[model samples]
Target: MIDKIAWLHLVDGRILSTRSRGKDVYYLPGGKREAGETDAQTLVREVREELTVTIELSSIEPAGVFEAQADGKAAGIVVRMTCFTAEYTGTLAASSEIDELAWLGYADRDRVSAVDKLIFDHLHEAGQLS
Candidate 1:
């Protein structure tokens, strides 16, 4: 299984998503945790590297956990994603391997990765997304 963390930046019923260079779909902003790093640490670092924004660790909170067949991988390979919601500093922009960023609503679900779709489902069910 591939493990990763994600930031669920929701505002006005939309979530933040990013597309990597040459990729067709968008993904939540965050990355795999480094050795010995906590979830919040990975989120703060990855968000900064990918979006040029600093996540306020003190405001970080668990959003959800989701798993799905890893996109473009062999069957049975899965990606486990842990998500968080938090306040941030600075502005958001695409950086690092990210080429574009978008604020996605429930109507844009199909444009995201499998695991991100699950996140959308949960958020929509909880009435935090639309």
Candidate 2:
């Protein structure tokens, strides 16, 4: 399993997602944890690197975890995504390898990665995403 972390930011029934350059699918905003880094530390650094925002460490909360076949990988390869919700400071924008940023809703489910699609379904079921 490829372990990863993700930031789940929802606004008005849509979730924040990013598309890396040259990729066709969107993914939640976060990445793998560095050596010896806690989830919070990884989250703060990844969010800052990918979205140019500062995640309010105190506001971090576990959202949910989801796993699925890693996109574009060999069959049986899996990605385990640990998700979180937190308040942030700064305007959201594409940074680093991100080519575009989108606010995706359930209707856009087909545009995200397998793990992210699971997250979308969960949020939709909870009535947090439309």
Backbone clash count, each prediction separately: 0, 0
Candidate 1 lDDT over residue span 1-130, tens digit each: 9999999999999999999999999999998999999999999999999999999978999988899999999999999999998999998988969999999999999999998988899999999899
lDDT of each: 0.93, 0.95
Error of 2 at 68 (Å): 0.4
| Residue pairs of candidate 1 with colliding backbone atoms | none
- Work out the TM-score per prediction: 0.97, 0.98
Model 1 lowest lDDT segment of ten: 90-99
Lowest lDDT 10-mer window, candidate 2? 90-99
**Residue 129 displacement in candidate 2 (angstroms):** 0.6
Where does candidate 1 stray beyond 4 Å?
A: none
